[model samples]
Each structure stands twice: as structure tokens, then as C-alpha cells.
Target: MAGGLNLGNHDIGVLAETTVPGSVRPGETISERPVDITLTMPELLRESTVTLLGGQAAEGASTDAAITLTTGGQTSTVAIPNLSSPRTDIPQQAGSPWLIPATGTVPAITVPAYAADSVALGMPKDFSIDATIHTKTTTLPAELTCGGPESLDLGSIPVSGDPVTEPTTGPTTPPTDGPTTPPTDGPTAEPTDGPTAEPTAEPTDEPGTIPVELVGSDIVAPGDTLTFSFADEWIAKKVSFELRSKPIDLGTRTVSVSGEASVRIPTDAPEGSHTVRVLSSSGELIASVPIEIEAADASDVDDTDDDYWSDDVLASAGGPGAGIAVLGGVLLLAGVAVMTLRRRAGRS
Candidate 1:
């Protein structure tokens, strides 16, 4: 172990245990014990007259944000320095030795290190390595500090009472029931003023006219006159009668007490059911009756049809002149026989 008092080109001061010598077995073996090294330095040292010419130190902290370092009753507040610069050299004041003994027994010796919950350097390892070579990377304060002036004494202060709210006259209580009557301030309706409309008269049916219906039997002979009676013929004159397309104007006549009327069926009218309509002067249908005419018998009229002489009839009759001659010969024979009888009677 070599203790160095470095202040020249290397550093202001450095103490390291470069190697440790001991006996070991021939085979590869792990050492279970850690070698402890003690480091000592003066409390103060003079600045070197040999001017150290090199790159400048890293810039100070970019932020004024205060950081707290606390160890037991001591606490310190400081701003974290900027780490972007190429150099970081913090000369530590020599005081108590921060003894970093290797933890327990290990397979091999490792560099001793010190860590505490109260202290942390924000600078990264590469930043510290790139920093200007110095005796120490971190500086130790004379004592630990924290917070603004009196932050550590916060727990001593008593919790204050709940804030008292002042009373006010503003309306906060809800009404027990809603307001009663409807508001009368709304607009009023105005009455309409214009011409009064006249009431229309109801239509009345004309008197002296009534619904008429024809009543009669269903059958009528060929030349027979068809009689039809009205059921409700009310006061009308000159009702024109129609049988199919033929019209029989019953000129001007009042309805009889029996309300009966007659129209003749023509002899030549084809026998079938004929619709008879009685229309009033106003062209309104007063009555309708269906009359069926019986078919005329064939023998009812003179048979003017002659029998047609076919060839067979003519042959049976010996034609025309032969039949006439045969009739004449018979007549002559009958006359001669009468004369012979008369002669015979006379002789007797």
C-alpha cells in the first residue's frame, strides 16, 4: 500500500491500495477475507505554486433548486451542480475518515464504498470520470444541513382549529311550500268583431209528388192489354209509358181512384218479358213493371203456307196431264153404266 501526497500533474492528493500479497493454493481459489486499508491526510494544504494548466472545471448548477442533506440532527441545503461540463473537481476538507469497509467476507477484494440515505451526488459516473482529475470527486461539508432555516422543527407546531365561517344574511333556507295563485300579469285575449253570418234554411221536398211503384201479375197474353196499378202515385198527370224502346204517351189524364193504367201489347211483339217504365213529366221514373207475354199459337192465324210438291208427290199423282186424263175416263165409264141400267130396266 502506497500513500500518495499528490499535488502536481496527477492530483492534489490521492490514497489507494493498489495490491495485496498473500499465499494461495495452486488451483484457482476464492479468498473469503477482505483486506482493510487506512487512508490519512492533512486537515489543510497549501495551494500548489506549479500552476495546473488544463481544461476548466464543469459549470456550476444550472438550477437554483435547493437540495437537502441530512444526517441525524445536522442538515444542509445546496443546489445540484450541472453535469454536462467535462470537468468536476471538489476538494474535500479533511476531517473524519469516511471509513468504507468491504461488506462481510467476499470471494475477492473490491474497492470500498460509502453510501448513506442522507447524502447523494446527482452527478453521473461518466461525468465524474470526464471531470478534471482531482484528489476527490465529492466534497464533504463541515456539518449536514437541510430545508429552509426552520423546516426540521415542523412537527412541533400544533394543528390549528377548523376555520370558523362567518355568518351572513343571504337567503339560504328553502321555502316549505310553493307559491299559491297563478300570476295575473299574463296577456288578456281580445274579442273578435266582424260581420255576423246568416243562417241557411233547410231544404224541403216539393209536395204533389211522391214515389210510385207498379204492381201487376207476371204474365199476359200475346194481344192482351197489360194493366198496372200504382202503389203510391201522388198527384201527377201525363205519365209517359214505355215498353222497351216503344213509347205510348198517355196524353193528359189524371190518375184514377184505383190508380190503374193499361197499355196494349202489339200483336207482332216478340213474346218475352218486357220492361215497362212509367216516367213523369219531369222525366223521373215513377214506376217499373216486368210483363211476360205468352207466345202466340201457330194455328191462331190462317195457314197461308202451301204444301211443297216434291218429286215423290208428283210421281204419285201421275204428274199433271196424266192424272187429269184418268179422272175423265172414269167419269165416262160411270155415265155408260148408268145408261145400260136404264135400258135393262125398261125391258123388264
Candidate 2:
């Protein structure tokens, strides 16, 4: 169903699968197994006069089932050699009514037995089909809907065998055919789709040049550690970081093997319209990144000594507060003398 465009009769579906009994003994050789491989078509599929053909498999694999198709008139039989790489070639025939198995059903199937190492899995895990397959599947002269090939995915079911005896070692027998413990990362070893043709990163930039990434965020304040990721070509190379507005060397740093490094901005870095420059080998400028070194906020510096007046003038400067404190002290002494004079007059 993964590749179905549903162009043809959407109802025309085929669920071809095989079922096994509840138990299968591990590590045991089997006789010529008689398994029921069924092709369950939608009831509406019987309306179209097309024969559901059998299959052909890829090399190195053996899968077989006897398949019979009937249109309203004559009956024909075909063989699905291997369900592993299941494929069926439906030959075009003129004047033959589309077929369904007898009474719109498939008869029971008899499969060849497999030796210990060469058993066919009841459920074919890799049910793959390509577009060209539809040239045969839609061979019906009367049927029309999808004009293109649709890979008919007949879904899967379990296999039948002797119940496995309890195992002392690993799984008694490796599974015959199924997905691996962890599925492969890709269909093939290498990727067919290479790196993106164009990206904003280093690969798409100037040749011999690497990228400069601002770690965490682009916005930062003075005294904060600024992290950067650059091209691996500069790994282990020393680079000088400088404030770009009339350049001041922040410091020199060695790029890490991972093409990344960090430098802390100085507390005294100037506040202005700004950018930072990175110079390779500690001197010659290579690139500049715009930055804004903001001015210190009100709470950043201590103002506790504001009330002190002393020869350390920069710290304790002149203001109306000093004169105001002296004036208040004199007024307090005069008020106390006036109250004493009034009390002496009252006692006389």
C-alpha cells in the first residue's frame, strides 16, 4: 500500500499472504510443507474480468505456490515460484474473461519443504515491487482508472512449523528470512542522494573557507563567555579575537579539534556601534562578525560610598548633600539653646 496512487479501482485490492499453525520447533528439518497461500481480493474485484496471476522470484531464493485464475469462462493455472521477491507476469490474452479463483476464491496451496539452513519464511519481509509490474497486473482490456503502474503490495502473515523446544543457547535457529536485529540505515551501503547542492553553511560558501557559528546565541554581554564553531581546517590553529571598531585584541585562542572554541569578553570592552574580528595565526584578519557590547546597567557597579566626602575625590565628589547636612546640624544646636532660656525665665 506504500506506493499505491489509487488511480485504478481503489477497491481492487489484493492481500496475498500465508498463515502458519501456532507452533514451530526450532532447529528441526521440515517435510515438504503444505501451507495455504491466499490472495484475498475485495468483493468488488470479482466484478472486473481480470485474472489474478501467480508470481516469479529473484535468483538465489525459492518460493512457490500453485495459483489458478478464472474469468467467467475458461480456467488457467500459473506458478508463483518464490514469494520472497514475489513477482507475477500476467500474459495478455484476447477474448479471455477476467478471472477469479473458483467461486471467487483460491484453493489451498502445497509448498516444497526446506532443509535446515534453507527454509522459506512464511512471511516475506521485503515485499518490494516496482512500477513496471503494473503493465502485467492491469492487463485487463476492460479495466480503466489508473493509467500508470501500481506496485501491488500483497501484505504478510506468520509461518507454521513445530513449536520450538526451550533453548539453552541463543535463538535455536537464525530466522530464515526477515528483518535484521536492527534494520539497515539505508537501502544501500552508501547514500545515493549526496549532500545538499546548496546550503548556507561552509560547504556552499567560499572554497578553502569554513563557517563561524555563534554558540548558544548571537546576543551576548561583556564578561560573558562567547562560544564559536569554525571550520575544521583551523582546528589546533591559534586565532586572535579583536573588537572590530578600531580593533582591540580581546585574546588569542586555540581552535578545538571539533572546529569549535570559546572566548570570554573582557569587562572593560567598549560600548559602541561594534563588531568582532577573528584573525588567523594570531594576527592577519580573516572575518568580522557584528556585535553590540552594551553599556553597564545601573545595578552593575556599587554606589555605597556616595554619602562619603574625602580627599579620594573621584569616589566621594561634591554635591548639595554635604552643605545640606552641615546646615541641619547648626539649626539643631540653636533650637536647643532657645528652649533652655525659656525654661530659666519661667522658674524665676
Candidate 3:
């Protein structure tokens, strides 16, 4: 049986489940729907927990699950079993002889992407959590059930400002590699019949500045618009842009135009380095700007401290909340009264 954590006072839970049937053959996967949860003010959730209740597999078979969350253009994934350790939170008052057995845990999760969004908003947003279940081994099918009421801790929620992107004035300085001195008319003297030295052509560099400038947060979210500004001199010279080899036309621009263009990052764009190229009407390369899309930060997202489950915090939470247990292959359910408390902070 999976045990519940001691969350001081107020509590909110969303029932988690898979979209497909519970049973699956070896190497099979089951998809899940996103779970929406509402949290109140001052409820900082530093960690989250999910319980895996009913699941049976043939002898020697192995089962596993992964959790994925997408919020604010950032995605995170968590694998189960190997990644999560056992959690034992059975209380003392239950009885001298313990009855509740240990249940599988999915480990505690802390999505910084959603955490940042939550900090920005005064209310809740649609943070999506999806589960992917997998199993392998023995010939018999495996049964895995997603236990009810996934909980988020209000006491330790990590909060951060929402990501923002802003336009920037294009760089004023030209590339340093530009030819400083003009090519000279070399070998003025005429040579005889022998092979003569050829005058070498000096490389020329483009004179214009890169049209786009990234400002505000370099942390870009999906669908976030990046504003590109063309040099005032080139706005009317018929210039275009290309990102990831895809052409982007600025359309016909008037001399009085603002010289600013915007490109929205695709929601499905892969995380890594990308380049945007500025080109002239005759297919000449003008300038290129490099951008980096961060692979979501997953550090500490799975760090569940054993100290949080110590007798101190658990005692403050007034013992464990009600949980289910299995004995001798028989299902047993018990009810316990839980006291919840709420504290409010002054409005800013």
C-alpha cells in the first residue's frame, strides 16, 4: 500500500488514471490524460506524490511507468520503480500489530516550469500531467492501476516569475572581419611568357547588422514571439529571413515602416541550438544570429527528502491520512478522520 505524506492542514487532490484498459502484454504501453489541479494562495508545493495501488503481473515480470508534464513551453519526464524508492508512513495509533502493507510509490515530483507559472498568476492555470505505463517479461498480461487522488504539497511549492521575451535594438557595430583596406592593383609590371603571379581578390564582409536581437529572458517558451528589427537603411531594401532553413518573407515594406518583424517559436520545436539567417534580395547572406532552446531543467524535480517524512513533520500533520492495504491477496479498506488546517498571508 502506498502511504500519504504529511501536508500541514489544507489539502487538494486530483484523481489520476490512464486512458486505456488496465491490462497490457509485455512491452505494451498505456497512455493517460492530463490532470488539472487547483491550489490556493500561499500553498507552496515543493513536492508532489502519486500512488500506484492495484497492479498485478505474472511471476518474474517487471512493470514500470513514467510521468510527463508540459507547462510554459517546458517539458519534464519521470520514470518509476528504479527512480523511486519505497515510502513507509504507517502511523502508530492504528494498532500494536501493523496491518497496512507497503504500497508502490511514484516518487515526489517538482516541475519548475509549472512552478514558475504558478508564481506569476494569482490563481491557477491548466498544468498538464500525463502518465505513460510500460511492462515487460512473462507471457501473462500485467494489470496496473493508477491509484486515486494525486496530491501536491502546499507547504513547499517552488515559485518563480513567468518567462518573458522582449525586442531589442539591433547591434550597431559591424563585424570585425570586414576588410579595412581596399584591394590594391597588384603586379603592375607586365611579365614575359613565363606563368605570371595572379592578383588575389580580398574577401569582403557584409556591412549591415543582424536584424534580430534577443532580449528579456533568454528562456523562451513555446509560442513565444521573438521580435526582429531590420536596420533602418535596409528595411526598404527587400530583405528576408530564414530559421532552420525555412524561408520567412518580410513582405513589401514601405520607407516609413517600423522595420520590426516577429517570429513565433513553434510549440513542438526541439530543444537545442538554432540559427536564424538574414538574406538580401539576391540570395546573399547578410548576417546570422544563434539561439539556444533549453532542454527543460529537471534538477531537484525528483529530489524527495527523507527528512520531510520524518516523525516531526508527520507528527505536525497529525499522523497519516487514510490509506488502503492488501493482505493475503484480499483487499482491505479503512477510514480515518483527518484534521486539516489553513493559513492565509496578507495581500501584497
Candidate 4:
């Protein structure tokens, strides 16, 4: 009966307690027996190559038994082997162990059933076992389903509630109301009257004798005192005084020998019928007068002051000095024909 089971770092003992003597004896005089013992430390004895188990020995009696181990302060012994009992009920080879390597001071095996059966068997009983090793977990690959062919033409794509057209052939329906009725055979008719026959009067070119006149045949409206006397045969030749109108030629002058000339009409000149030609010092086609030009009449100033005299001397003296008395009666009949030819040549 030794006692001390601390186990905080080892200290335990319960070395022996035997029973199994008469096997099931429940009578006569063995009333002080109580053998329900248990002790264990094997997780294979935390191996160093271990094996130890022992218990039945009674035939010749010396069946070995001892087990002690201490780690880190080194102490170890184990030898508990020997067993044989089970005559005809077969089930006994239970004692075989022997690991001994402790030389002198052994005392550290405390296996109060390896700490009460590893705390009632949840398992680690003093463990330090090792060897499951294994390793392989990596995986990842497999994925291919297979898809491709929809390159395009998704039903001509326009579908989001479609409706958008606007082209029924070129410039669409806007040209209908035309050609109302304007071709009744093109240029109708409504013009006829019969006598437009007076345009046949074309015999004009008759204007030559411009024997000069207009020293004032009537003018005044910002007037310019006119003059122009010609006709002694255009005053002996160096003549050049133009001023025609009927299709204008209005200017040119240079004829002087008392052929007395002048011209001024341009108070913006155009009052109508005008002509004044007389050209000749080689510019020939000599004469034209036709005057009219109206617009000015302060009582016409008596024909612009009788145009200053010589109407061919008042038509050969029908008025001014009677034209010198008809030129002295034609020189008195040329002296009475030279006195009758000198009396007929003195009667020859």
C-alpha cells in the first residue's frame, strides 16, 4: 500500500493489487476484497520501439514484472512478460514485453492509467507518437463547354419597336396638281383693225438750200443771240457751219466773210424740229434749214427782232430803200443803149 498520485509533472504509484484466486467465490470468508483496478500508459508506450504487458503467473511462480520510465532525466526499464492460464475456455496468451535501458536509479513511470486512462479515454495518454505524413492537395483545370457561330446577321437588326421608313421612289408624292388647262392651242387671238397703211411716206431727202437764216427766228429761254447770214454763194467758199438735227450733227463752224455766222441753241437744245446744214469747203452737200424749236414766247419778241434785216434786202426792195430804187433803174437802161449806138455809127 504505497500512496501519492500527483501527476503534475509526474509522481504516481499503484504497483500491485491481485485477485482471481478462487474465481467467483461469493461465500465462506473472504469479505474484505475489492479488486477493480486499472492502469495504462500505452499509446504504444510513447515508443522507442515499445511493448510491455504482464499479469498471469501461478504455476511455478516467477513471472517477471516491472516498468518505469522518466524522460529528459533519463531513466527507463520495462519487463513484464509471462502468462498462462485458461484450460478449456481458450483466450489467454496475454503477457509479453521487454524494453530495458536504465542502469541505476529508476523512478519516474507514473502511469496512473496514464493519467486516469488519458482522462477516461479521450486519448492522448502521454503521447508523442508521429507518422501520418501524407501531402497532395492541388487541383484546378477542366473547363470547355464549346461555343462559336453567330458572326452576324442577327435577323438584320432593327428591332426596338421598329417603324421608320421614308422613301417610296425618288422625290416622293408632292407633284400632283399641275397642268391646270393653259394650252388651248397656245397664243389665242384678238388683234385686227385694217388701216395702219400710212407708214408709206418715205420720200424724204429734200433739204439743200439752206441759204442761211436764223439770226433769230425766235429764241429766248436763257437765249444766246443767234446769227448766221450766208448765201452770197456761201460768201465765197471757206464755208463750214453745220448744226443739223433730224438725227443730230449739231456742230462745226468757220465761214465768215460777212457770211456772218453764229450759233448758240444749247439751252439744252432739244425742243423739236431742227436742221441747219450749209457745209461746203469740201464738206459739200451744201444746205438745210427747217427750224421749229418752240418753248419760249414772251410775246415772241416780234420774231426775235425781225432777224436783223436782209431778207434778201426785203425781197429785192419791196421795202428797204426799195432796194436802192431797183438798182437805179437798171442803170437807166444802160444809158439808153449808149445813146442809141452813137446815132447808128454817125450814119456810116
Candidate 5:
């Protein structure tokens, strides 16, 4: 049988001895006595226990013993618990010895080895085992180095402790030579007489006027042509056109004495009452008209009529009857002349 046993730090040994009584011839009258065997480890003489088995008490005998071996204080004993048939081959028992402490101290049991039986028996190995212990400590001083000069000495330096002298009566006072100086009187200020007058703002003159008229009294539709005529003579420098209802400024254009200005109504203008104002360059109010710009529809038709007339024509037509009065005066003069001639003839 092939087996192994595990042992501790204590020493151990196996001893075997054979003793026979008065020996007799073999196969004749004979008496054979069983031999006693003991296993010991002297280094484990302290309080330790050991278990033994598988070895025969006598070779070629039918007797065997299993014993628990213990040692204490230079003495050891073996107690046989069971018996079995003996054999020449020894079957090893696998166990570990108890750790014994120093002579007077209690034995300290170390942690079991992590190696398997095959490793412990010197089989081929691939790995290693390691144990480690760690410790840490810290120390601090009562006072710390804050890093600066501690004290300043102004030795043998003269310092005045007396109260500062102040001027009892003077126009101006002097300053002191300490951290807080005496407040001196400021310079005397001259007084003013009365409230000053403010400049007045001049009035602005109003701008010149420009007369305008719409072509018709009806609403103007989108894509419809609008004719703007001047009621008075046109002056290019003084007149400007603006869509007052909208923020559009249709630039000014010069026209003839009896001419008209035509502009296409913008398509984006809203369909509602809109006002167009003619303003002077000086921003004076001149003339304005509220025109209705209608939306395009099937019923909307383009109508043209004599909606505007020239001021020159109107003034000429409304003048006094000069020709008729002139003819009446000539006929009266002729009647008077004929009467005078007839009287002269009668007298002749």
C-alpha cells in the first residue's frame, strides 16, 4: 500500500522490534509472541495528540493495532482502539501535528497549509503559496510651523505720548503726525447773487403746402390705375407723396401745370379705407384724401369719367361778362352819336 502522513514541526520516528519466548522447532511444538511497536516524535513532547494506524504489530501475523499517541512533559503513551489483520505493506495516515508553543507558553496552532495531498507528497508542482502581514503607524506634533516672523522690536526709538497741540484761534489748522490726522478747515467759498436766466427756444416755421385730388369719388381696387392731379401749380422741390395709412413713401415727381400723376394700386394693400397725404419737405400738413381700395372681384369694372377739372379752366369760366358789357356800351355810344348828327342836320 502507498500512502502518506502529514506531520507538524515536532520530530517523529517509528520503531519496530520483535521478541520471541523460548523458541521451538518450526512445524513442531512452537510458541510465537506478538511484537509491540511504538511511533514517537520527541519534539512534540508538549501537550500534543497523534493518530496511528495501518502498520502491523508483528510481521506475517493476523494482529494489527490503531493507536492514538499523546505526549506531555517528557512522557508519551499509546492507546490501541481497534485491531485488524496484519500485512507487510504499511498504509499511511494523512494528518497534521498540533503546534506546540514555547516551553511555558500555550501551543499556538498555525493555519493549515493550503497545499493538496498530491503537492504535499512531492508530486509535480505548478503553483506557489505565499503569506504576508502588514502594519501601519502615524505620529503628529503638538505645534505646527505656520511660517512667519513672530515679534517686532522698535527698541530705543522715541515716541511722543503727549496730546497733539491744536490751534486755539486761526484761519486754518495744521495736520497731526499720527494715523488719524486733525481735520483742517476747507477753503472759504464765495456766494452767488441770484438765479440765472435760461435761453429761450425759437419757434420753427411750418412747411409749404401742396394740393392733391383723387381722380374719382369711388373706391380704387387693386391693379386699378389711380390718377392724382394737382389743384394748384406743381413745384417739384416743395411737394412729396406718402401713403399715410401705410408706411410707404412714393417719391415726389414733377408734373405740368395741367398734368396728372398716375400710379398702379399695389396688390398687397389691404382692402379698406386708406388715406394718402401730401406733405411738404418741411413736414407741414398740406392735403389728404381717404380712398377705399377694394378687392378684385368679377363685378368690379373700370369706370372713367370727368372727375377732375383744371383750376385755370374753372377760374376762366367763372369770370365777369366783359364782352357783353362792352357791346352794350358801344351801342349806346352809337345811338347818342346818331341823335347828335340828326339834330345838327335839322338845325342846318
Candidate 6:
């Protein structure tokens, strides 16, 4: 927001107004931009907003002005264009102030960072916010820093707080009410003739480097192809595929000279975390890639479905209900027999 007490000369430019959340996380800043020599070194400044006020620009003009920003000891200038939308509806008469909104965006400035943190923000007031003409008072602050809520709800971020220690477990006590004396009535046991040797631990095979690189999407529906390329030992060799968790063999394919291969995820593949294992010709396991087969879409099912009385079904069943379907022929035989009897009666 910007209005004027005839700020006829003063320009705007509140320094280092706000901070954006770090690209990956949130943090804190000193925010109180002091007048002392406080442009700290070795920090990152970004996403700062500096607003200018009271400057007059011709409406609908296609002109741009220069704004300089210095940060991390490097200086850069950006062009600020005139606002396309300015409030013209404000009454230009006396007693009313001309409140023009601050418009136009400046690219992320690589300015000096504050508070000695490498990624902190700092402000250098090299530009002018005061009017060259005349104004009763400076309406805006000359310096501002990005400071606010010092923490994030993402677990706990150690912004300005001290580290906390973990709690230790307490000791447990033994049960009472039982006799403390040991029972001596048990039979003596004989020692085994052999010193029971500790069983040799089976050597576990560490995962080998999968020379393969996935070519396409790992997440796919059944019937979609999974493509990947490989190098080294697996090149130009037959590699069998396996769908882990379900133990479905996904067939085998010979790697091309280009070390690439593709396999279709069967339409019957289950919707879950599935591993596509690559194996060598001798059936040694190679690297495995994870894939997700989504549930088959019900809408993809064919609308022309067959039922019990369908032509194909009835033909396969030898007719609807089999022998019971010959009732029509039996009825025709009865009619013929009835007609013969009627003719004999007529003759009589």
C-alpha cells in the first residue's frame, strides 16, 4: 500500500523487506536491519522484495527503470517496468491521498546474506528511497530484514534454539515372593562326546551392481512396456525377468547390441510393489529394478461381454440347457399323433 502527504519528491524502496522459505526448508534471520556495518560475509540472499513509492510513471507507457542490487559482494542491476494496472479511480481532488500499489516483480537478487549463516539474507541500501523534490516526512522505513516465526512443524528445525538431549532408560527390579534357595533334586546330565561346534554362518551374497538403466517409466499398468538398457556382462545375452513378491516369470529376452531390452507388464500383474529382476543366461541374479503395476482400470474392460445364453456360450454348451432344449421337437411329435387320432375319428 502507498499513499502520499504530497510525497512529491520521495521515492520508495524499503530495503530487504521479506524472506522466502529456503528452496528446501525454512529458517530464521536477524530481520532487524541496523544502521551499523552489518553486511555479513559468506551468505546467500534470495527472494527479497524492495518496493518503491511516490515515483510518477506515465500511464500506459512502455518504459523501464533501472534498480541496482548488491549481494555477496557482487552487484547487479535489473529493469523494473511500469505497472500495467494502476488505480485511476482514486479522486484526484484535495484532502485525498494518491494510494498507488507497489507493482512489478524483480528477479531473485543475489545480495549479501545476514547473521553469518551461509544461506541467510542481507540488505544494502545503495538505492534511494527519499524524494529529491520535497515531502513532509519519509513514510516508509529505509531498512527491513526477513524475520518471523523461527521454526517449522517439520519435526524440529534447529534455527535459533539449543540442541536437546535424548532421555535414558531406567533400571528394572527383580521379582520378590519366591524362595531364594536353588533346588538340588534334578538328575545329573551327561556331556556330549563332541564339542558342539558353532555352525558355519552362510555367506550372504551382497547385491551386485546392476549395469542396467531403466529406459521408461517404472510405474505402469499391466500391458504397458518396461524398457531398460544395460552394459558390461549382461550385454547381448539372454536375460530372464521375474516379478518378485508374486513369483511370476516374466519371460526372457536377448539384449540387443545396443544393450537395450523391453518387457511388457502382464495385464494380470498384481497392484503392489513389484521387483523386475534381471538374470543372466546361466540364471545368475543380476540387478533388479522396482516397478509398480497399478490396478487394471475397470473402464478398460470390453463392454460386449458374453453371458450363459450368448451365441458362443450356447454353441459351446450344445444348446441352452442341453437335452432339455429338445422339448420343442417332442411337442411337434405329440401334435402329429393327436392329428392322426382326429383323422381316424373323422373316418369312423
How well does each candidate superpose onto the true structure, as a TM-score?
0.23, 0.27, 0.22, 0.17, 0.24, 0.27
Global local distance difference test of model 3: 0.34
Deviation from native of the Cα of residue 345 in model 1, angstroms: 99
CA lDDT of each prediction against the hidden true structure: 0.32, 0.38, 0.34, 0.31, 0.31, 0.39
Q: Estimate, for each residue in 1-348, the C-alpha lDDT of model 6 and write its tens digit.
A: 011011111112121212233321122222221111111111010001011123122111112222443323454444333312232222223334322223344444332332122232322221111111111222221111111112211111112232233479765976767878877687678778986887668857747665888886788887677787887555435577888886888766656445676667777777878898888878888778898888777787554532222334546657655423422221100111100000001100
Backbone clashes, each candidate: 8, 17, 10, 1, 3, 6
The alpha-carbon deviation from the true structure for residue 316 of candidate 1, after best TM-score superposition, in angstroms, is: 43
Q: Write the per-residue lDDT of candidate 1 for residues 1-348, one digit (tens) a residue.
A: 001111111111111121222211212122333222121212221111011212112211111222233333444443222212222332333343222111112234211122122222111111011111222232111100001211122111111223334477867986658567667786676655864675558646566644554455667665555555555433213355677646544322223334554555666676777777777768888767777878866676434322212223436768756543332221100111101000011100
In model 1, the runs with Cα more than 4 Å from the true position are 1-215, 232-236, 245-253, 297-348
**Candidate 3 per-residue lDDT over residues 122-165, each given as its tens digit:** 11111111112112211211122222223322221223434333
lDDT of 4: 0.31
Q: What's model 5's TM-score? A: 0.24
lDDT of 4 at 9: 18
- 1 or 2: which has the higher TM-score? 2
Model 5 lDDT per residue over 1-348, tens place: 001010111112223232322211211211222333333223222111111111111111101121111112121112121211222222223333212111111111111122111110011101110111111221111100011112111011111233233459865868766858566688466566865765557746546544677777548776565667675544212355666576666544333224454445555677888777766668776678778877789675434322111223334545335322322221100111100000011100
Q: Name the candidate, 4 or 6, with the larger lDDT value.
A: 6
Clashing pairs in 6: 9-131, 10-131, 12-53, 71-111, 71-112, 72-112
User: How much does candidate 2 score in TM-score?
Assistant: 0.27
Task: Output the better candidate (2/5) by lDDT.
Answer: 2
Tell me which residue pairs clash in candidate 3: 1-102, 1-103, 2-103, 9-341, 44-156, 44-157, 45-156, 45-157, 46-156, 46-157
Q: How should the candidates be ordered by lDDT, best one leading?
A: 6, 2, 3, 1, 5, 4
Model 4: lowest-lDDT 10 consecutive positions: 339-348
How displaced is residue 25 in candidate 1, in Å? 99
Per-model root-mean-square deviation over C-alphas: 71.1, 39.7, 24.9, 81.5, 66.1, 35.5
Task: Show model 2 residue runs off by greater than 4 Å.
Answer: 1-209, 297-348
For 1-348, candidate 4 gives per-residue lDDT tens digits of: 001110111111111222312211111121222222112222222221111111111111111222233323343333222211111111123333211111111122222211210111011111100011111221111111011112211111011222233458677567768785766875586666876566657766766665767565643342344566776555423344444554544344433434655555554566766666667657876667666666766675455432423245447548656644433221100111101000011100
Candidate 5 — worst ten consecutive residues by lDDT sum?
A: 339-348
User: 173 in model 2: Cα distance from truth in Å?
Assistant: 36
